[model samples]
Target: MSKKVLVVDDDPDVRSFVVTVLEENQYTPLVACDGVEGLEMIQKEKPDLVILDVLMPRGSGIRLYRHLKTDDALKAVPVIMFTGIALRSFLKSQKALEEFKGEKVPEPDIYLEKPVEPQELVDAIKKKI
Candidate 1:
């Protein structure tokens, strides 16, 4: 069966592009506009993998990622953080959040900066799933 990959991003253009790439590569693509909806879909669908973006409205990807990593049931699902945010900045915020929560979660299974080539995204997904 084709793997299901949930893509969470507020940007419509980026979401659409990712969806197309996944479809072309024979993977099923699921989408959510922001982290709020993304979390809902993640629980309901239990996708094989997730592609997430940072800095979304109404629940940032960072919050959702933290929740996933800390949840025993969902922690095994692979996540690829696809964002425009710099790696250093993202790590700093993640560290601060972990400190505040008194919990340390593992980093994403894969971290891909935005403007990722389609082949690169596919390869990452293939590796994770």
Candidate 2:
């Protein structure tokens, strides 16, 4: 079976696009609309890789990454953090975003601005997995 991948973003269109891309690349793609849902998917699905969006409602992707990072079960899962938030571009990244933003959030394993290039996404996945 192909490797499973989880794509988490609040934007439906982005989720659809990412799923399509992963499927086309012969990967099993799972979709989640928000960080809360993403975390649930991670726990339930245990995908080979996770693609997350940082600036999400209710929960933040960066926080989710740290949660996974510290967890013994989820620590081995590779995470790709994509965010449209511009604040990080102007600030320095730390061990976590919550510390840097102080109410904002931290950065993902890798950050991508919106309008993601298809190849960039693929490349990121390939490297992580």
Candidate 3:
């Protein structure tokens, strides 16, 4: 059976794009609109990997990442941080700031910027699985 992938993003366009790409790559793609729904789906679907957005309504991707990272059963699942915030400088500064504030910001297995290339995403998922 093909591996299952969960994509959680607030943007419908991003979800559609990722889903289409995943389907073409022969993977089962599950989607959630926000982090809260994503978490629910994660429990229900138990996807092989997750493609997550950083910002969303209700709950954030970072929140879900933390939950998964801490949960013994789910911590092993790989996550990909897919966001519009892809600047290396910004990510570094954000990490530093969060560290200074004593916040725990765990890095995802892979980080990709918005407008991800289909081949790139598929390759990343294949590598993870």
Top candidate when judged by TM-score against the true structure? 1
Write the residue-wise lDDT of candidate 1 on 1-129 in tens digits.
Answer: 998999999999999999999999999999999999999999999999999998899899999999899899999999999999988899999899888988999978889998989999999999987
**TM-score, cand. 2 vs. native:** 0.82
Pick the winner on lDDT between candidates 1 and 2: 1
Residue 9 in candidate 2, Cα distance off native in Å: 0.6
lDDT of 3 by residue, 22-111 (tens): 999999999999989999999999999999998898788767877888788999999988888865854675587577767665667898
C-alpha lDDT of candidate 1 relative to the true structure: 0.94
Q: How accurate is candidate 3 locally (lDDT)?
A: 0.87
TM-score of decoy 1 = 0.98
On residues 1-129, what C-alpha lDDT tens digit does candidate 2 reach at each position? Answer: 999999989988898889988988999999988888988999999999998887788677766777787788998888887777664552444434556655543335566677788889998899877
Ranked candidates, highest TM-score first: 1, 3, 2
Instruction: Mark the regions of model 1 whose C-alpha exceeds 4 Å error after superposition.
Output: none
Listed in order, each prediction's TM-score against the native is 0.98, 0.82, 0.87
Among all windows of ten consecutive residues in candidate 3, which has the lowest summed lDDT?
Answer: 85-94
Clashing pairs in 2: 97-105, 97-106, 98-106
lDDT of each: 0.94, 0.79, 0.87
Worst 10 residues of 1 by lDDT: 101-110
Off by over 4 Å in 2: 87-108
